[model samples]
Target: MPDLSTTYMGLRLKNPLIAGSSGLTGTRAGLLELQEGGVAAVVLKSIFEEEIAAEYDDALSEAARKGMSLESYDYYDYELRGAHVSQYVDFIREAKTAVSIPVIASVNCTYSHEWASFAKDIEAAGADGLELNMFFLPSDITRSSDEREKVYLQIVDRVLKQVRIPVALKISSSFSTLAQMIDRLSKTGIAALVLFNRFYSIDFDIEKMTVTGAGSLSSPAELAGPLRWVALMSRRVGCDLAASTGVHDGAGLIKMLLAGAKAVQASSAFYRNGAGSAGVMLKELSAWMDRHGFKAIADFRGNLSQAESVDPGVYERVQYMKHYAG
Candidate 1:
């Protein structure tokens, strides 16, 4: 059998398949299922910064309705942050105890604030690593691109300062200069970078005349974007690259590795096929590796990336050719 083990974000994975954060990985039972199904690591479902703030605001409104004093708002805010952090800390501790595979705590934060310090609590709770799901929609026309990019950098810097464990960033590809942004972020001392987060899109409900969700889950075709960027940036960036979004099967997993992703994170596949999807993908990868006469992941990984490919321009090509379009 080919050795599938690889290192991601400075942590050794039994294999390169990671169960990405989702409802499937939010609970102790879910973590065990992923481990039993053969995932090398698990990124716990992210604790959202907005969710905490929303909860705090709701609680304050309730307190006000009950005639709470004005001075109590500060206490309420502090306790609210603590309440969510305490629960997440316990979740991390329990997950660490239940499973031996690396438990990577995830935080979905829009800005670098008091919540960045919460990473320290997660680390102290025995999380092996942290993955920051950092992104903000660049819809504000008044904000310059540079100003928006600084938010991501500041959050990363603050979080890294608070935790000793490896930190990886899961980011969106929505940037004016994505390559430059990736280069700058990679130099900020992160252990790994997950290319492209799949965000919830808005869809119009024609019949109801209201907005609804648009394609909540990713299709295999979605892999092309990240695959291209990973192949282009894997060698150029200062940190390891992990591919996220649009990976649904073993072939997709293998392609990500070939494109130079040190690891591949799968969420929708697990949701569609259950935890066994990880095992299925690994089996397929191993069989492919054996057929190719490769003994380990590193032996063939990045073999097709832009840096190593003979036809490197294929990755750089953007415009659809008339010959192909026709």
Candidate 2:
């Protein structure tokens, strides 16, 4: 059998498929299921920065209404925040004990605030690694790209100082200078970078004249953007790269590996299919490897990246001029 094992962020993985951070990885039961389903690792459901702040504010407001003492206010603040952080820490401990594969704790943050310090707790809780799902939507008309990009650096810097374990940054490809940003971040001492986080899309409810959420799950068609960037930047970046979004099966996984991704993260596939979908993809990958006479992941990984491709321009080509003109 081909050696399917690979390493990401300095941690060894039995295969390249990772259970991306989602509700499916929020509990011990879910972690065990994914392990049994044949995933090499699991990124625990992210602890949202905004959610913690919002909940803290609500609790403080209720305390004010009750005319609590200043000391009581402090108590409530510590207890509320601790409850959230402690629960996540406890989950990390439980996940580490419950599954043999790596447990990567995720933090979804928009700012470089006190929450970045929580990474230490996550690390102390026995997490194999940490993934910062950091993004700041470029929606503020007054804010320049440089300013927004600085926050991402600040968050990574803060968290890096707080823990010794390897860290991975999961970011969106929304930056104006996408390639430059990827290169800059890769030099930040991070172990890996996960390309393209899937943000919640909004859709119009024409009948109700209100906005609603678009499909939260990614479709297979969504893989091309990350694939192109991974192929373009993998050889150039300082750290390893993992492909995210649009990966739904073995073919998608294979495409990413060829594009030079060290690993592939998937969530929608499991939601649309089942947890066992990972095992199915692995089986397909192994069969394809056997037929190709490849004995290990390293034998073929990055074989088609732009740096190694015969027609490197194909990856950089934006227009379909050749196809249309031909």
Candidate 3:
């Protein structure tokens, strides 16, 4: 059998497939299932600063609606925030004790002076690594793209300085010069970059004039967004590339590896096919590799990249002259 073992984010994984951060990976049982199912590594569910803050906001509003005393409101607000962070701390500890696989704790942050302290504490709590999910919302008209880019770089430097473990950034594809951003971010001494964390979108029920949350899952077609960039920048970037979103099967994993991805992270697929799907996926990949006579992942890794492929323009070309001809 070919060597499926590979290094990702400076950590060795049994294979190239990782269980991405999602609800399915939030518990000890789920983590064990995924690891047993053939995931090389697993990124725990992200602990969002904003989500923790929202608990406070919701408490305050509920207190007001109930006509509560100011004293009670203050007590609830303080208690909620502490409980949130403390729960995350406990989760990290339990998860570390539960599994031998690399447990990467995730944080969804914008720019927080508090994150440095949080990163230090998370590392202390037994997390093997940190995955920071960050992006500047385009809805902020006051901030220029350059300014937003500065925030991301600063965040990277701050957290990296605070943590001893390897750090990987889960970023949004919201930059004006994405190629430049990847190049600069890679130089920041991080271990890896997870392409494009999918943002949560909202939908409006126009009939009822109400707003609702969009579905959390990503479709298989969604992989194209991250796939293209992975192929283009994989060879040029400084650190390892991990493809995220829309990876549902063995074929998708093969495509990512060929595009120079060190590994692929999957989330939505487990929800669609259950945790055991990873086992099935690994078998399929091995079968395909055997049939193709490729002994290892490196044999054809990045074979489709612009720098490595015969038809370089196919990866970079946006317009076909055939379609534009008059």
Candidate 4:
């Protein structure tokens, strides 16, 4: 049997498969089930910045409708903010006590603000690390790309100052100079970078004439995007890389490792198969390693990365002119 243990973001994982943030990791029962299913770590469901902002807005709107005095409105805002922070702290504490595996707290935000102070409470609640799922939709026609990219750095700087634990940033692949952007983020004292966060897609309901979400889960075929970048940037970035989005099985997990990812996060695979899918993937990983005559994860990890490949240009090719025109 080959050794499956690997370290990610300074946390020692028994295996590389971490149960990524989702509803499945939102409670004690979910955490316990994932642990039993052999996941190395769990990133709790993200506390959304928009959700907190929305709650405050709704509270103020309701108070105004009731003709509440200004004093009462101020009190309601304070109370609502406290309630949200308290609930998240309690959840983190409970999860830490319930499982032996590392529990990483996650915050999904687009900008840096006072809400980042909550990271202090999360560290105090005993989270092993923090994963910031940050993306600024560059939808504003007036906002330059430089202005949009600065938000991520600003948020990370503020959050890192607030917490003592290791921090990782989960990002999307939408930047114009993706490699430069990622390298800049890696230099920000972060412990790891999770490649390619999955974003919600808008689909038109032709008959209803309304918009709906595209499928909420990633498909197996979705692995290619992260795979390419991980292989390309793994040798270039300043920090450890963890592959996210579209990793569905042991094969997907193996591909990520060979492509130079230190770890791989899976959510949709468990949704489609079950939490036990984690153990199944690990089993397959171990078997493959044995057949390849590898004794540990480090033995073959990054063996196929772009840095190590003779034909590295294959990873840089984006046009299909060669294949299609032929």
Candidate that would win on TM-score:
1
The C-alpha stretches of model 4 lying farther than 4 A from their native spots are 65-74, 323-326
- Stretches of candidate 1 off by over 4 Å are 63-70, 324-326
For residue 57, give model 2's deviation from the true position in Å: 1.7
List the candidate 2 regions with Cα displacement exceeding 4 Å. 66-75, 322-326
Q: Report every candidate's CA lDDT.
A: 0.93, 0.93, 0.87, 0.92
Stretches > 4 Å off in candidate 3? 56-82, 320-326
**Candidate 4 C-alpha lDDT tens digits along 1-326:** 88999999999998999999999999899999999999999999999878878888899999999998999977976788678888998999999999999999999985577778889988999999999999888788998899889988999999988988999999999998999999999999999999989988999999999999899999989999999999998878889999999999999999999999999999999889999989999999999998999999999889889999999898888887878458
Candidate 3 per-residue lDDT, tens place, 27-125, comes to 999999888787988999989888877777888999999999999976985677568767888999999888888999998886565546688878888
Quote the lDDT for 240 in model 2: 97
Task: Report the candidate with higher lDDT, 2 versus 4.
Answer: 2
TM-score of each: 0.97, 0.96, 0.90, 0.96
- Look at candidate 1 and give me any clashing residue pairs: none
Give the alpha carbon lDDT tens digit for every residue of 1-326 in model 1: 78899999999999999999899899999999999999999999999999999998898999999999988888998999999999999999999999999999999997577888898899999999999998899999999999999999999999888989999999999999999999999999999999988999999999999999897788999999999999999888899999999999999999999999999999999988899888999999999998999999999889989999888888888889997567
